[model samples]
Target: MNTTPSMTLERQRADAASARRPEPKPATGSFQTVEPRLEIAPAGATGGELVDRYGEILTPAALEFLAALHDRFAGTRHELLAERLQTRVDAANGRDPRFMPETAWIRDDASWRVAGPGPGLEDRRVEITGPTDRKMAINALNSGAKVWLADQEDATSPTWANVVEGQLTLFDFLRGDLGYTSPEGKQYRVTAEETPTIVMRPRGWHLVEKHLTFHDRAGRAMHASGSLVDFGLYFFHNAKALIGSGRGPYFYLPKLESHREAKLWNDIFVFAQDALGIPQGTIRATVLIETIQAAFQMDEILYELREHCAGLNAGRWDYIFSIVKTFRSRGRRWVFPDRKAITMTVPFMRAYTELLVQTCHKRGAHAIGGMSAFIPNRRDPEVTERALAAVTADKRREAGDGFDGTWVAHPDLIPTARAEFDAVLGDRPNQVDRLRDDVEVAASDLLDIPSIGGEVTEAGVRDNVSIAIRYLESWLRGVGAAAIDNLMEDAATAEISRSQIWQWLDNNTVTAEGTRIDQTSIVRLMAEAVAALPRFEGDRFDDAISVFRTVALEPEFPTFLTVGAYARFL
Candidate 1:
């Protein structure tokens, strides 16, 4: 369990790397930008006294905490995001991303490892992921799982009410007050004996918390980073309570594209802990190597956060989305055939996970597998059996490949996922000592796009179109995670679905049935896809179709469909 002799040196190096980027003096600045716009109102409420509804938690001190984070880090965040555009441009011009030679020292230093998992994060074999709404939060807590990923990012829509109330839900959950009553008079409660450990996931770095604005001394008003707002408020309110209960504020950091971003988070953690008078490593984070850029620097990313790092998660959906977005402009070789064909077993994806497991175990970190898409159908026995069998095979492969744990969406898939891990990891909290040294992955292995076998089919196109429109409709209606065709579709689903359509049409792809994919065909399919949905008085199908066309049928590809749609709708 011992790591390297120097966690401080990495911080010093990060500090030096970010020295050129200007940060504010301290966490003491007043972020009063036009009288505190971070207040929330329930959906459909025109006007009422809304301050007292959430005034208990969004106090002066919490707002100050958020301002301090923006003052010190938001400028640097802008620079990093701007750098992404240039990277994509370079990638489009026949430049494949390679491992950073500058950070080889971090990767070469095998003695350095991420900090061991904090309390309640040791055995994460069956972690259920869902939104932080009151009812869903209660269900996830009592779902008989080891960890509940209280996701405020991908699984949640960034509505004014949803964002603020999610924090209230967390505040309530830790104090044994996360209870709910259904319209049918059904009660939901969490018992100490039955509840799972909570590991919250905030929004990604690319998102902005529009409600919280900060006006600088230069007289420019900018929105606060969603990452900062979510992490800052949660840490300010609950770090001490979680620490008091013997479990630290554990987190699943999503959508990090570089080690520099990891370094920024490390600095944020250091500052927040220091501000709160907590210990240096009291906070623990597990980075998701979801981006293709992050996949190439997994070692450096872990090293950057080694002092407060727990492990790494294989975020399969976003990773694939990143691939499509990264290589999207590069011609026919990079065009993905079908969304369903690109499973974890594909050569490139297998390379990504294999390298992740080897890198994490070599440095004494947990290598967690991605989520399983095996949502059980309650009414059909045959469908339930198929779901279980598929989940069993998926988890078995992960366990066999040296994954310490795996993720399942539904509670019904837990026994199947846990049994596979139990078969491999009996009596041990994890398999960190199982060194996968035989896995020698090259840059070419991770970029093996042509190795996957499958052709574009008409069913795949129709499904993508249908899912994109339907998912966006739900998202625009403030529902981020929706189950369509027995799969939990989140923002990542929309990104991949739209990105694939863009890539196929851009490359003039033909389906296996000899049908050409073009803007005309896509427009026709969009009408069919939208027409299939039920008509209601307040349906957002029109907006959803517009969003789909803007992102999928446009001349230039958009990085994330959620970004533009969020601006116009949420």
Candidate 2:
């Protein structure tokens, strides 16, 4: 079937947006940072001037490409976001998600396989993840892991400087010319031979690039999809060069709730490949089955993206966040214990990971495991040893459970994770052949949240309050991921921390110390936690406390705190 004229025009716009190389001189001046400029200022799209230094990135063609993506797919994205609410309502009202019956054929057929792993992605036993700052980017790439996840979603605070400078960093990284020197005189440079392969994880679909706006047919100003802006700029600039160098443009798709969302991504991949005149399967992506709804549809998700699919990941943090968000209103039966108590070994989490391994191997894809978010505490050798042991044990279990690989937040943990997987994998690139036929999981198993019952203690409550405020303060200061209390904390950590409080308050639960989580106690704890926190020199410290209180004490749960917080700050 032929597409409508509008879609055709959209395709043309995207195709025309690919930047042609003619070596435009770098913008010169003492650059004053500003909002990105609009070259093709459509009726509803306008913005502040782009800094002269970033002009090469925000060229007329690049903005048009992002505009095209907004015009063509933004409507469907809105409908999908709306549908998530209905899905949650149905789930709460006894329509719990199971394997879809209609897609049985897709699962039963055994011959279909995803395109094999691209050049540098063959053995992904250890991958390090971090934000795209100049120093961190160099450190992560130089980390011994096989892949470095240049993260824009959880690891990045999407300030205007972060958004624009991140694009510039990736462009420079890919060109083998990126370098940075700290004020203390530590120099960093890319290790061409030893650098891990790059896999960019864009902001999730739920986020919008507030710095750039696109107009719709009705002349309404709409925030361009964060995913599009990140993916478009990277692909537009680096696709051909990466392909020529034997590594193609790779991605880690985050926060998908359903197979339909995966289908939308597959369509986007198809359009992106065609528009750029690349091979259909050139762009490979691994879907992070992070949502509760997505856990039930792993098979369908891989099937939808088979041509462009790499694998599925156990996005543990957001998976927990999804569980809380989906069943927040279902009362005490679904009330979870402390965040630390919900380990991967729990029956429900075990079932989810087992199902993921089985589904991925059955369909010829890698099964990646959860993040071991243990940041080493260098000040205390005993602390570092314990964290290392725990990380080692976690990777050991994942490798034994048939996972092809796992993730680490710090470079120090890479050797530990790699050692465990190395013992299992040996010389093999991946264990995709380990089809887990013995495992069987059901809907009740996935929804079994209360099975691992532990006491919610005063310490846990204080920890939640403490982590939320500190993480948010760091986030507002333009750092997304931080090491607090010897643990790596990100946006997902803050979300779970706050939402768990809201759930406990909503259910009127008492802590192990006999403290009720009413609004009064919550406010008191917030004040105490803020006081206990080290004084950071900024008004945003207070802002973090206020935001944390509103989200934790409000009657209605906020879908995502970052969405509102972004509007206020970024």
Candidate 3:
């Protein structure tokens, strides 16, 4: 402890010399090797502190591993790690079916009240007939569609005259003077006015190859940039530029099948937004759910780009074709009728509707029903009234069944459909109450019994049978049909009742042997059922029962019954 300064200096010099000298090599048979040690700070410690602490705990071998980990997690590199983790999180959450339920909880709460008024028919459909008629186009726009699809997809001619004229006319509508004709053989003139209702559906993706032309104002041909040759690119660029000028049309996204396809569109939208200096959410999109796969995975597709999606539409004809094509390979194994003869009451249609309603409601979206293809016969008052009446009835039924709105093919049908929806849903209680109750009942543990065989007694079965038979009888006779509580009957009881009825038919238990078990008989039976139920009221339920009975009594019913009977026989 009491060393002289010269002795201390000599000791330090000896230590420095020792540090500079090379370390001794290990012997071939040596057993002593240094092991690495690592130190980890508490979870919340800062990077610098953690690094210092880690250095303190690390042996030579551990220092290398710590340096690698630190380098991987540092600065811009950390964002890459975060992205990888986020991707894993997305995959995990996306795979969970329960994720939708949790995500939809807020929507479920908000949709509890019946949907309020939305952008009406005046906000959804537009018609364009002539190829280059700007006046006609402007007049059509007067119909007031929120977004108009100037359809080069289906409505335009394939000739160059038509195509160029159409393009020029569209330009004129946006930039040049437009002239109008009055009823009294007078002409009215107006200049170009910016309108939001003029989206163009360029010839489809497959047909773009046929429409490539590169020419300037001098009518001289110019070399086409391979990128500009694509119709999608051209349309995208021009539309984006027009949008920058505050005159662009929102896109009606077509032919999307997968979430990847949606993301592709989202990418394009993002590009357009950045290039045009437009706000990200300013451009709206309505995805056409036409393909079978699109229908099933629509929720995922929408959720992927929910910020960009305006809404979705039920593309009926394409959907019908999709269904037939999708199931055609299954051959006779499928029980459904030929596609042409199938009605909306079929199970397929029911499933589609259910899925559509659920998806739209879960996203706080407007559930617009399919179009009525009926046209009015205005010459005959009776025919017109009947058509209007039929449309009103159909729309009312759809609205009552929980659709927010519907589409009509003709301009005249729009007002009627709107009126029907307004009449049905404007003042009524929301349908969400029933959905909430059902969800609650389904989730309750008390209702989780495995089987009803021991619990359902003979007396209980007999009472249900008796009630069902009486209800069926009243329904068939069409007596007091408006008073049946059809929803209160369980599926088991309905099956038993139908079984008993068939048994009676088979055993010749009824007195009228010659009376065929036809549609009429089925209708009467359902009417009887409605009459027997005490809790039900209103003609609305009766109407529903009538429709259901009609469906049940179709010729297909017998075919279904025969199949079931034969299967049981085997």
lDDT by residue (215-317, candidate 3, tens digit) is 2222322222111122233243345555555544455554454555566556655655665466666555656675555665666666666766645666554
Model 3 TM-score (2 dp): 0.46
Stretches of model 1 off by over 4 angstroms after superposition: 1-52
TM-score versus the correct structure, for each prediction: 0.92, 0.91, 0.46
lDDT: which is higher, 1 or 3?
Answer: 1
Top-scoring candidate (lDDT):
1
Cα RMSD (Å) per model? 7.3, 9.3, 27.7
Which has the higher lDDT value, candidate number 1 or candidate number 2? Answer: 1
Q: Give a tens-digit lDDT track for model 1, residues 263-341.
A: 9999999999999999999899999999999999999998989999989999999999999988876777888989999
Cα lDDT for residue 10, model 2? Answer: 41
Where does candidate 3 have its weakest 10-residue lDDT segment?
A: 440-449
Best-matching candidate per TM-score: 1
Q: How accurate is candidate 2 locally (lDDT)?
A: 0.83
Worst 10 residues of 2 by lDDT: 18-27
